[model samples]
Target: MNGVDPLGTGVPGPREARARARAGTAGPTAGWAPGHAQANLIAVPADWAYDVLLFCTRNPKPCPVLDVTDAGSWTTSLAPGADLRTDIPGYRVWEDGRLVAEPADATPHWRTDLVSFLIGCSFTFEGALDAAGVPLRHVEQGRNVSMYVTDRACRPAGRLHGPMVVSMRPVPARLVPMARRISGLLPAVHGAPVHAGDPAALGIRDLDRPDFGDPVVAEPGDVPVFWACGVTPQAAVMASRPPFAITHAPGRMLVTDVRDEEYRLTL
Candidate 1:
């Protein structure tokens, strides 16, 4: 790959983005690697792997499974030669359902009994909406997109259960339709907005405060659009309290080699 600005918005290709991410210098990945698919990481003990995968299978909207690594492997087909232990800009180490550490490099925390899952992230579809002339407030403010955990519960699967989490993007009322239409085509990446206009409908009482990510300022006439977020798995770990787990810190995604169009459905 030719040299490019590693931290420039919409500049670096997937490989360059990963290189920057691995260095822990890339800022929030909400809009990086424009055309590449980004993913959420959730690694659990081998014994808990099947349950996690089943949870994703049962709750596809908030937990769309993109790739799964064999127990003990850190590399994924999503990004050949990429190291799950350190490629992402950030990671959350969990023990008994509580966040124990926020590490940029998780290599020292790796375990042979762990199996990793890469779930579809809404960030992968931001470029689509951007191309459609839809406004993205988080990208505009250079902030992490807001995410909230809802009162809505996901279908429980063997040993795992939790509330669904959603990412919020404020879109101009008129462009809401275009944003939805374009994003709805990419089901692999959380698809269409699960809710728009009212945050209370999802039990989110405050638009100013979010469970994960920084809330951005919404412009007048901009409606809050909510989409199923990949962070739901972390919510699961919080609720289920597995012995141990590792997940991508909210808004910090694994930039994969897969192109975003690969997951978009045609008309």
Candidate 2:
């Protein structure tokens, strides 16, 4: 519970190191640590962690778990000394399926009964897309990834069950297959597109209105491609109304000790 602040009060020593380790800061060590593994964050009651872990296990495409914290433990041993309470840039608190607050740190609300889950994110695949000459409109426009709750029901586990949430990226008709191929290699991070061509087929009523993130132009000759999203877990957690739940804000993730290449072989 007593760890140094990352905001530069002084040269970080052991306590600071423990704090940094718990925070899961990886990438760009000059200002922040680089090449360190980054992961998605989910905080739930210890009672719920078991079901959620089972949910993630059943639905690996959408909820690929990277690490889990022991009940009452804040240090991220899986990712090396990262703190789950304060490492991320932001946190979202949900009550009964609605977001109540976005806090900079979860320390004030941290509970001994709480446990943390680190999931894989599609951001891990952005570099691969750029390398393959696919353009990500949201990244280019400085917007959050557009996500939607789909008609598709994820394989239910225990109390966790809900429509799959997906992130959209418009690809040129000619390059849609290539984009799928590149992403298909990384199944732990949502794998390949679940649906391509018609958004209505997935029960997405409007392309202009998204459940999360900014709407991007599909453009001429572009097709809307969807990937199972980490947000699916958040949505399920919210609907289950587990008394208390915490998750990373959109676009914020737990940078980790694992590498993106690890995902390519996880399946």
Candidate 3:
């Protein structure tokens, strides 16, 4: 973390997080670098870029597009010096719609014809909920937030289409409303809980075994809150199976220089 500003602003920033990732010391990015925005990454061939972009636009809630890099470029305006090929702690390599590898660095698989996209993440709103005194079960238990594949299907765009995926957070019944308000302010980060209190409504029969990420034990009096997850695009891409693709490992994200406040959009 030498070149990274670990103490800048008296808080851990994206650079520090990326450095930890590069050093192979980084774990889940959910609780790290509080207050800074985190993003989900997906890289695809230029030929599929239009469909991917359209897929995101059609499913804004789950696939909010933040920053997109030019073909073959690893750099983005989100993080000046960060390299997309190596900054994330983990990467998932997919072939023919099946996940083939989960590597720490994607440098070896870098392609000159690839187009990378940064999608809004729900992790960015966790800090706000923490500040508001809302309990986060996953953070408290040191586990990744639970995510599930819902019966809800996203609007199809070209060759991309799949069920909507969501991240589940157990918020206290009393704080559920407050959580919505606090998170609702940040549209760029998958703002607010799309559903609360009923897991069955989303086709999540057992919360203990999630479709992705770790199961967060819901405590007494806690209600399960669901947010549109960035992973939705990965699911869509996987179902469509674009021959070759790469995405950040579930729960692992690319921390960005953009502050959480920057994503707060208002009418």
Candidate 4:
């Protein structure tokens, strides 16, 4: 089944072909699609694209951008044949800083004035952590990574600004340095731990509560290690109160053709 146009005619481009092939598939293709890249998706107005792109450039720790699409173009040449409109399993639409809806596909909301930005996700670093034998609680429990909005302000770029959001993974105090070493190798996916000991230092006052995703047991002798999360852009978009914005729901990343290792070298 090819991608049917709004008019009901089947489109025959490379994107259409891949969309037809990978349709209805869901979840992180991690371990399955070995060496394939996974991206974080942020779709906002074309007018905001440049400012947001600059925000990404300035705050590379949280918004490591992988690619940007021309206004209204859903096909990403950087991640060939992947259709941004429907490739991802879930999407969240925000209006006036509130979540309006979450849909499995965003084609219905696609607009010529809309532009897509693909950011790097920390999921790219999971392979490295697993390779080093750092057990991730969320992955073991089949839950999403826990995310918190910190009082730490991101360096503002134009109107794109907000508190930094960090993803927490509880590590044995002994393995904290190992985890940092493994994750630091991929800077594009948010390198190193922004906060390793007390969440209070980063203004994260609660450990049981998270602004996004599921919370996990820190366990005795386990220290919560935090990394600047890709979700930081979503927080910024909400704070900016853009007329319209779209982002992948937490854990539902935009899987790309770029490999995880590619991020290790200069991005």
Winner by TM-score: 1
Clashes of each: 0, 20, 0, 0
Q: What is the TM-score of each candidate against the true structure?
A: 0.96, 0.83, 0.95, 0.87
Model 4: per-residue Cα lDDT over 1-267, one tens digit each: 111121123333333323532575444322323345567889889888888998998899989888888888887755676778787767889987789998877888788888999888887777677777787777666567789999988988987889889989999999999999878888888889898999899888888889988878766888999999888989998888878988888777766666778778552
lDDT of 4 at 204: 87
In candidate 1, which residue pairs clash? none
**lDDT per residue as tens, model 3, 214-241:** 9898889999999999999878877898
Instruction: Tell me, by lDDT, which candidate is best.
Output: 1
TM-score of 4: 0.87
Q: Taking the tens digit of each residue's C-alpha lDDT, what string does model 2 give over 16-65?
A: 43355346442211112222335678888888888899999998888888
Residue-level error in angstroms, candidate 2, position 120: 0.9
Residue 188 error for model 3, in Å?
Answer: 0.9
Question: Which residue window of length 10 is worst by lDDT in model 3?
Answer: 1-10
Stretches of candidate 1 exceeding 4 Å from the true structure:
1-6
lDDT score for residue 107 of model 4: 84
